[model samples]
Target chain A: MSGAVLLSLAGCALALLGGLFASSPLSARRYRAAAALAAALIVGGVWWVADPRGDFGHPITAEAVDANGAPVSTVLVLQRDGGRRQVRRLPLRRPVDGAEYALWAALLLGLLGGGLQYRTRDVGPRWLAPALPAAGAGAAAVMFARMGGLESGEAGVRAWLARFEVGAVQSFTVPDLPWSAQPEGTVALGVAAAVAALALASALWTTPRSGGERLIPIGAALAAAAVIWRMIEVGGLPWRPAEGALWAVAGLLAVAGLERSSALRASTLVGAALALAAVALGA
Target chain B: MPRLPRMRGPWATAWAVVASPWTPWALGLWVAAGAALGLVSEPGQHPASGLVLQLPAALLVFALVARDLGASTARLRWAALYAAGLATALVGGWLAGGEAGMAEVGGARPTESYTRTIAGRSAAAHLGAQLGATLSADGAALTLAMKEHHVGEAVLPLDGVREAHIGRWALHLVDVAPGDEPAYARLKLTPRGGGDPIERAVRTGSGAALEDGTQIAVLRLSPDFGRALGPAAQIQVDWEGGSATAWHFVDSPDLDARVGAAPWAIELVEVATEPRLVLGVRRDGPIGVALAGFGVMIAALLGLVFAGRREGRS
Candidate 1:
C-alpha cells in the first residue's frame, strides 16, 4: 500500500478506536477530550490524504474483446474526466478494479466512528434526523435522472439505422415491448423513485414530538425492500447481487430492524457488521 | 424452590453464554479482525474465496448480536423463517440446474440500409445507385461497398468508425469483425501540452517504442488493407499505468480512436455492410425462492413495526 493509503487506514483505525473509547461507560471527561482530539486528527489526515480533485483530465480507452482476446470494439474516451467515465461503465461492471476493499473499509470505519461520536454527544438538532434521509432521497433522484429513459437495445439501434435505410427490410422483428417489459433500468428507476418519495416523507415527519416517528423505520424498511428487489431484478443469470447493492440493502434492513429497540449508535454498529457481511458475500 | 427447574444441560448453558450481552462485543471484534486480516492478506480477491469458512459462524454471531440488541422473539422467529426460505430457494435451485432464468433464444436477420442526405435536400439517397450494399470482412474491419449504377463505388470502413456524417445524418460505428489479426497502421501521436508530433508506420506483428515510454504496436491488420477494401487496423497503445487497443480506418480521419487517459493523443490513420443480425434476448432466472424470501422478510418486518405500535397503544 502507498503512504496515502496507509495514512488513510491509520486515520480510520484511530477514529474507530477513539469513538469506541469515548462511547464506552468507563470513559472519563479527559478520555472524551482525547477522543475529540483524535477525531480532529482523523479529519485532517483524511483531508490531507484523500485526492479531492481526483484523477481528472486523463483519457480512458475501453476495449471489448471476444473469447480469443480479439478486439470487438475499442472506444477511445477523451475530454470526459475519469469519474464521469466510471459512471458510464456502472451498468456493465464494477467501476473500480483494485483497492476497492480498502476504500470500502475506510468508508465503513469512518461511518462507525461518526455514529459512535454522534451517540456520545446525544442526538443533535431535531433537523439532523431528517438530513440523512433527505440526502439519500436526493441521491436516488440524481441516479434516476442520470440513468435517463429506458430503451430497447435493439430497437434503439434499429431506429437510428432505419433513418439511414439500414436494417429497414430485415426479416428480424423485435417485439416493441411496453415500458413495463423493459427491465434494464426501468425497475431500478421505479424503485428509486418510490424509495426517494418515502425517504422524503420520512425526513419530513421524523421528529421527537411528531407522531410520524414511525415513518423512519417504515421508510427504511421499504427502501431496503426496494433495494433488494432491484438487486434481484438486475442480477443476471445466477441472481447474485452487486457488491454495492448488497451493502446498501443490508445496511438499510439492519437499520429498519434495529432502530425500534436499539439506540442509533448501537444500530450503527449492527448495520456496519451486516454491511460488511453483505459486501464480503457479494465480493 | 419446589424442586426448582432441573439443572440445565451443557448445551443450554453454552447457548446462554453465547447469547449473553458481552457476546455481541466479542463477535464485533472478531468480525473486525476477520475483515482486517482479509484486507491485509488478500486485498483484491473475493472475500468469499478466503472467508467462506467463517460465514456460518458469522451468521450465528449476527443472530447473537440481534438478540442482544433487544430484537423480540417474534422478530427473531420471522428472521429465522426468512433465512429458511432463502436456504430452501438456493438448495432447490441448485438441484434443478440448467439455467432456469429467461434468456434471448433467437435472433433475426434484418436488411439494413446506409444512406446519406445532402444538406437542404428533401430526398435521401443510398450510397449505391441500385440500393445494393455488400459487407465484406477484412481482418478487423468490415468494409461496406455500395454498388453505384452511375460511376465509381463508395466504400465505407465500418470497423473502428465512430461517427461518420454522410450528409446530415451522423452514423456511429457499432460492431467490428471477430477474431484478431496483425494491424498494418500509420499512427500520429500528439503530446497533450503541444510537442513535436511523433509519426510512425507500423505493420502487423511489429511495434515501436517512443522516447517517452509510449509503446505502440500494430496488433491486427486487415487483408487487402492497402487496396482500400474496408482497410482497417487494430493498434495497441500502452503507457505507464494504462493500455488501450483502438481500431483505425484508412477512410475515416475524424474517427476518435484512443483508449484511456494518456498524455499523448494517439491517432491511428490506417484502416462493411450486411443485413444486421438483430438478436432478441430475454433474460430470466430462478428468483422464485429469493423473491419469496424477500416478501416474507418485508412482511415480517412490517408486522414487527405494527406489533410495536399496537403494544405501545395498549
Candidate 2:
C-alpha cells in the first residue's frame, strides 16, 4: 500500500505489458505507454506515502485516582516537546493479509517477466519471459513483507526504525491496540499461504522449451520464491533501506540489460532515472 | 581509407580515462570520507550538513559510474543510471532521517530525554541565551554549553530531572526533599562566577526565596510521583508512588519549592561541589541499549550501499 510498493508493482506491470506486446511495433508502443503509466503510479504512490501531515494531540498525563477522591496509582505520560524534538504516534496497521500479498506479489512477478519479453529482442520463448517479472515482484514482495505492521500498536516504532540497532532488530511491541491486533495477525498468516499457493500455481502452469525460454521466468520464479521464503522465514519481517536498495538496484540493472534497442534502452534509462529520482525525493 | 581500428582515436583514450575501473576506487575513497565525517560531526548538525555533503559524494559516485557504463551503453543510459542512483540516495536518506535532527542526535542510550520550557524572561534570554549541555555516564559530570545568551525570568520545568549542582556565578541548589519525608538533604558543590543570593535563599530556608543570579534546580523521584509541582502554585502529590527517577540542571540555584507541601523525614547535608542534575532517566533497558547500537550500524550501512552501488555498477 506504500508508494514504493505500488511503484514497484506498476514498474513490473509495465515491463510485463511491454513483453506481451513485443511481436508488433504498435504493441511495443502500447506497452511503452503502460510503462509510462506505471511510472506515474509509482510517483503518486511515493508522494502519498511520504505525507508530511502532522498530527498533534494533547499529551497523556498519568493520573491515579483512589477509591474515593484519593490517589491510587500515578502515571505520567511525560511529554517532552522542544523546538528540536518532535515525536508522532503512528498506529500500526495489522500485518497485511499474507495471502493477498502473495497474490499481488505473484502477479507483479509475472508482469515483470512479461515486460522483459516484449522489450528484449530474443527472450527465448513465451513461457520463459515471465521469469524477469517474477524475480522483480518476488524480490519486492519479500522486502515489503519485512515491514508490514511491525508498527502495529507500538508507540515508538517510527523512531526506532529511523535509527539503527545491532543484533535482532527490535520492533516496538505495543500493548496490542484493539483495532490492529486481529487483522494484523490473521492477515500475515493468510498472505503467507496465498503467496505459497500463487507461486505453486505459476510453477505448474508455465512451461518453456529452451534454456533461453526458461531463463527469464525461471529466474523470476526463483526470485519470487526467495522473497516468499524470506517473508516467511523472517516472520513477515521487513528490510532496512540499505538492504532493500540492493534489490532495487538489481531490478534496475536486470531490466536495463535485457534489451539493446534504442527504444528499450531508452525506456530502461528513463525508468531507472525515474526510480532513482523517486528514491532521492525520499518519498 | 586504411580503417586501422578507427585509428585508435583520442576519443577512445578519453573514454578509457573517464570510464576506467580506477574511477570506482577514487569514488569509493570520497564516499567513505564523506560518510565518516558525517557520522563524526556534532549531533543535530549532521542531518542538514550531511545532506549537503551527500551531493558531492553522490556526484562523484555517479561520475565514476557514468564514465564506465556510458561508454558501453549510449550516453543517455549512462546519464540516466547515474541520475537514478543519486536521486535514490537523497530520497532514501531524507525519508529515513527527517528534519527534526534525530539523525543528528545519532547515538542511542537507555536514558530518558528531557527538555526545559522556560516561561519567564531573563538576561540570559537573548542571543546566546540557550544552554545545550549533556551529562556524562556518571550522571554527576556535565558538558556545559552556552548558546545565544540572553537574560529573562523563565518558568523552566526541568523534566527528567534527577539532581543538580549550581556554580556560584550562576545558581545554587538550596534543598531536595522526598515527597513522603520532610528531612531536607542539602547538596554540596563548589561555586563559580560568585554571588551571594543563593546563600541568602538557603539561610532563610523559605521555599519563597528567589536568588538574584542564574536559577538552577534539581528534582528527585521515587520511581513514582509522590509529590510534584502543579499548575500555578498548587503542589500535586500521589500517595501511591511510581515515577521514573532523574535530575534537571538549571543555570540558577534558586528554586521556588514552596510549590509543594513539606515532607516529614528528610536530612540536610552540605558538601564541597553542587550535585549535578542527571538530565535524563537512567533506563539502560534492553530497548534503549539496542536502539543506540543499531542506529550507528544502520547509518553506516546506508552510506556503504549508496557508495558501493555506483562503483560496483560502473
User: Highest DockQ, which number?
Assistant: 1
Q: Estimate each model's TM-score.
A: 0.37, 0.27
DockQ (Cα-based) for each candidate: 0.07, 0.01
lDDT of 2 at B17: 60
| Stretches of model 2 off by over 4 angstroms after superposition | A1-93, A103-107, A110-261, A276-283, B1-11, B16-314
**lDDT (0-100) at residue A142 of candidate 1?**
43
TM-score of chain B of each: 0.33, 0.29
Question: What shift in Å separates residue A206 of candidate 2 from its native position after superposition?
Answer: 28
Tens-digit lDDT track for model 1 on A1-283? 1222222222222222322232323222122222222222222222222222222222211222233333222122112332221100001111112222322333333333334334445355533432332343234334423433333445543442343332222222222331211111222222222322332243334322312324333433453455344434333212122322232333333333433333333333333433333223212
lDDT of 2 by residue, A1-283 (tens): 2333333333333333233233244334323333432333232323233222211121111111222322221112233333221212222222223333443444455455435544646356533543444343344335443543222223433433443332233222233222212221122222222322333333334322211211222222222233233222322122223113223322332233222333444333323423332332232
C-alpha lDDT score of every prediction, in listed order: 0.36, 0.30
Candidate 2 CA-lDDT value: 0.30
* Alpha-carbon deviation at A102 in model 1, angstroms: 17
Cα deviation in Å at residue B43, candidate 2? Answer: 14
